[model samples]
Target: MQTVEHESFGSPTEIREFPHGHAEILNVGDATIGRLVLEPGWRWSNDVKPIAGTESCLAPHFQYHVQGRLGIRMDDGEEFIAGPGDVTSLPEGHDAWVVGDEQVIVVDWFGATDWAKEPAGNVAAHA
Candidate 1:
C-alpha cells in the first residue's frame, strides 16, 4: 500500500444497483468499502433477495448510518431502527428496509464486496 491513500464515493470503483437502492464501492488497498443509498420503500427482502438468490441477507455488515432511518429485522425476529450518527453491526440472516419517506444512506465497512450481487448464471435484467 502507499504511505497514504484516499478514495471517494464520488469516484467509486464499482456500482451495483438493485430495486430502490444502489451501492457505490471503493477498493482501498486490501479493503472494500461501500456507500449504500436505499430509497424510500426499499426493503432487502423485496429488493435484494432476487439478486442475491438467498432467503435472507447473507452479507454481514458493519456500517455507519449517514442519513435517514433504517429498520432491521433478524431471522429470529429481533428488530430495531438505526438513524443518522448511529453505527450498526449486523450479522448474516437479516432483512432491512428504509423506515420513512427519506432515503437511507450508510457507509459500510464490511460485506460490501458481495452485497446485493446476483448469483452465478442468474444475472438480473435491470441495468
Candidate 2:
C-alpha cells in the first residue's frame, strides 16, 4: 500500500511562466494528473517570462476547470472562456489567465511528468 499526502509536499509551488501569465510544471505524472487551485485574484502569467528555451516555442497545455472561470488567449488572436465543470484543451503556443473572485480548481491531465520543469523559488507562489 502506498499513499502520498498532499500536505507532505509542504506548500504549493509555481514552475514558470510561459505566455499570457500561464505557468507550468514539467514531469507531470501519467497516472496522476496535476491539480491546480486558483484563489480569488489569482492571476497566472502566460508570457513564458521565466521558462527557458520556450520563448521561441510553445507548451502543450490541457486542463479542466472544476469550479471557477478561466480564460485562454493565443498570440494569433484566438481566445476562449471556461466555466465550472468545463473541460478544455488549450491550443499550443497560447496563454491562460484566470478570472472572477471565485476559487478556481483546475485538474490538469497532461500527466504528472509535466511539473518536473518548474521554477524553484517562485514555485510555491504560483499556488
Highest-scoring model, TM-score: 1
Q: What is the lDDT of residue 6 in candidate 2?
A: 46
Model 2, 1-127: lDDT tens digits are: 6555442122334443333333333332224455665566543443332443243214455677777887767768787888888887754555555677776767676532343245455342122
lDDT value, residue 91 of candidate 2: 48
What's the CA RMSD of model 1 in angstroms? 3.2
Please write out the lDDT profile of model 1 over residues 1-127, one tens digit for every residue: 3667899999999999888989999999889999999999999999988887778888889999999999999999999999999999998889999998999999999989878776657543211
Best by lDDT: 1
Taking all chains together, each candidate's TM-score versus the true structure is 0.92, 0.57
Question: For each candidate, how many residue pairs have backbone atoms clashing (under 3 Å)?
Answer: 0, 39
